[model samples]
Target: MPSPLRLHPDRLLPAEPGLRAIARELYAAVRELPILSPHGHVPAQLLVDDEPFRDPAALFVTPDHYVTRLLHADGVSLADLGVGRGPLTEPAARAVWRVLCERWPLFRGTPVRFWLDTELADIFGVTERPSAQNADALYDRVAERLAGADYRPRALFERFGIAFLATTDDPADDLAAHAALASDPTWTARVAPTFRPDRYLEPDRADWCKAVDHLGEVAGIETGDYAGYIAALEARRRYFVEHGAVSADHGHDDAVAEPLDARDAERIYRSAYAGQVTAAEALAFRRHMVVEMARMSCDDGLVMTLHPGSSRNHHAPSFHAYGPDTGSDIPRRTEYTTALRPLLERYGTHPGLHLVLFTLDETVWSRELAPLAGFYPSVYVGAPWWFLDAPDAITRFREAVTETAGFSRTSGFVDDTRAFCSIPARHDMARRLDAAYLARLVGEHRLDLDEALETAVDLVDGQPRRVFRL
Candidate 1:
C-alpha cells in the first residue's frame, strides 16, 4: 500500500517544545490573513479566461521551471516534459506525470517538495504519495477536479484568499484583461499589473530598435529622436498606472544607475537606434536608463522595484531551444551600495520615491542591502528572492538584515512566482517561517508575546501594502 500524503499541523515551526508552542500560536494569528502577492508572474489572462486547467501535467510540470529544471537535472528531457512544444495530449501528459512520480525522491527536503505536497494534499485532496504505481491514479484525480468549475483559475484565486495579486507585464500590453476583471460585478479582488520594461531599458538587445519603434507607436510619440524616445517611455508608464499598476519592475544585469549628460545621452541614443552603438556605449546607455526609470517613478508614483544581478538564461542552448525563464538564471556577486549610489543620490530622500531593492546575491544582504535601506527613506530591502526564497535562506536573510534595517525597512514577502497554483502554498511557507522566526524572539525574551503576534500579522498583511503602495 502507498503511504498516505499528509501535511503536519505544526509544519515549519520550531522543534523545541516551548518555541514550537509559541510558533503554533503565532502562525494561527496570521495563518488566515489574505495573501498579498505584490509582485508575481501569473498572467492576468489566466483569470480573465476563467478556464479549466488543461491537465495535471500542464498545471504542475510544464510551465513551472522550478519543477522542470530539477527534473531535467535528474536526467529527464524538457521535450519529454512537454516544455515549449505547445500543448500535450492526455497520454503524453500522463507520461510526464509518471516521470515525476517515479522520481519523487529528487524533490525530497526541497521547498518545491513542501509546496507540491501542500498543493497535492490540501488543494487536490490527494491521499497517497505520488509514485510510479500511483501516478495514473493521482493524475486522474487531479484532472477530474480541474475539469470542475470550482478548480478554474478565478475560483482558485478566490479560494487562495488572495487580497491583492500583481502580474508583471510589458509596457506594450494593453491590460484589457485587467480592465475586464475590474469591471466584472462578480469579481471583487484586485489583480493589478506591474510595469516591466526590461527589453526597453537594455538597448544592446538585438531587437532594441524594433522595441523602441513599438513603444513610440503605442505612445504616439516619435522615436527617431532621443527626446521622443524618453517621452514614449514616460507615456507608457502613465498608461500602466491608468490600468492599475502600482509598481515598475526592473531586472537588469546589474543595479548601476548612473546617467550620462544630455548631449552624451542623445549621442548614445542615436547610435543605438542606428545600430551603431559600441559595446561601451550600450553599457552606458543601459545604466543611464535605470536612472531614467527612477526619475519617472518619482514623478508618476509607481513604486520602483529593482531586481538586479541575475545572469538570466545561463544555458545558451536551452534558451535558444525553449526561451527565457527556463530556470538557468543564476546569481552573481552584486555590489549595491555603489551601483545604486547614482540613483539614490538623486532620489534617496525624495518622499515620492519608493525603491524596493531585491538581489539574487546573498552576500550583500547584511553588508550592503541592510545599510542601504537603513539610510535611504526610499530603499526597502526586498525579501529573499528566487533561489534564496527557500526556508534556510529566508531565515538567514532575516538574521542578516534585521539587525541593521529593522522590520519596517524590509519589504514583506513577495511570492514572485509564475506557478499560479503554488501561490497560496508559497505564502503559507513564508508565514510559517516568519512565525517561527518571531517565536524564537519571544522565547529569547527579545519580544513580548503580544508584540510578536502583532508583528506576525503585519508581516503578512501590512508590509506589502506599505512597501508596494498597494
Candidate 2:
C-alpha cells in the first residue's frame, strides 16, 4: 500500500504544544490575507497575457530552477526533465512527472519538498505521494485541472489573493508589456516592473560593451565616452520611472561601493568599453557605478536594492550549457561595513534616498547588516534571500536583527521566486514562521499577544507594500 500523505495542521510551528497552538491561530488569521509580492522574478508578460499554462512540466519544471536543480542532482539529466534543450521530443507531461516522482526522495527535508507537497495536496487533491506508479495519473489530473479557467494565470492570481506583484526588468527593456497590462480595464490585477541594471552597470559582465550599446540605443544617448554613457543610464532610469518602476535592483558579487574621480572613472569606462579592463578596474567601475546609482535613486525617487554576495555559476559545465539563474549560483562570505562606507558616507544619511540591502551571508545579519540598517537613514535590510530564504533562515534573521534594528528597520518578506504557483506557499511559510517566532516572544513575556498579532498582520500585508511604495 502507498504510504499515507497528509499535511500537518500545525506545520512549521514550535515543538511546544501551547506555543504551537498560538502559532496556528496566528497563522490562520494571516494565511488568507492578500499576498503582497513587491519583489520577484515572474515576468510581466504572464500577467499581461493572462494565458493558461501549457502543462505541468512547462508550468512547474522548466522555469523553476528550484525543482529542476534538485532533480538534476539526483542523477536525472536536465534533458530528461525537459529543461534547457530547444524542446523535448518526448515532452510528454506524464514522462517528465515520472522522472520527478521516481526521485521524490531527493527533495526530502528540503523547503522545495514542502512547496511541492503543498502544491500537490492542496492544489491538486493528491493525497498519495508522487512515485513512478502514480506519475501518469497525477499528470492527467493536473493537466485536466490546468485546462479550466480557474487555472489560468490571471484567475489564479485572483484566487491566490495577490494584491500587487512586481516583475524584474533590465534597463533596456521597453516595458510595453507592463503598459499593456495597465491599460487593460477588464483586468484588475496590479502588475508592475522593477529596474535591474546589473548588466549595464557591472564592468565585469561578459557582455558589458554590448549591454552599454543597448542602453545607449534605448536612452537615445551616445555611448562613445564615459560622460555619454552615464547620461544614457540616467535617461533610461527616468524612462523606467515613467513606466511605473519605483525600485532599482543591483546584484553583484560584493557590496563594495566607492566614488571615483571623473578622470579615473572615464579611464575605467574606456577599458570596459574596449573589453580590456583589469579585475581591479572592473571592481572600481562597479563600485563607482553603485555610487552613481544611489545618486540616481536620490534624484528619481526610486527605492534602491542591493542584492550582493552570490558567487554565481559555481558549476562551470551547467552554467555554460544553461546560462545564469539555473541553480548553479552559490553564496559566499560578504563584507559590508567597509565595502559600503564610501557610498554610505555620501548618501547613507541622505534624506531622499531609500536603499534596501540583501545578503546570502547570514554571518552579517547581526554584526553588519542589522547595525548598518539601524544607523543609516537610507538603508533597510532586505529579507533573507536565495539559499537563506527558508523557514529556519527566516526565523534566525528576525531573531538576529530584531534586537538591534527592530521590526521597523527591516523590509518584510519577498518571495523572489519565478514559480508563480509557489508564491502563496512561500508567503504562507514566511507568515507561519514569523507567527511562531512572535508567539515564542509573547510566551516569554517579551511582547504582548495583542502587539504580536498586530505586528503579524502588518508583516503579512502592510510592511512590504509601504516599503516598496506599492
Which candidate has the highest TM-score of all? 1
lDDT of 2 by residue, 243-291 (tens): 8887999998899988999999999999889889999899888888999
- TM per candidate comes to 0.99, 0.97
- CA deviation > 4 Å runs, candidate 2: 87-92
Tens-digit lDDT track for model 1 on 278-297?
A: 99999998899999998999
lDDT value for model 2? 0.86
Residue 273 local lDDT, model 2: 90
| Pairs that collide, model 1 | none
- Residue 20 lDDT (model 2): 87
RMSD of each: 0.8, 1.5
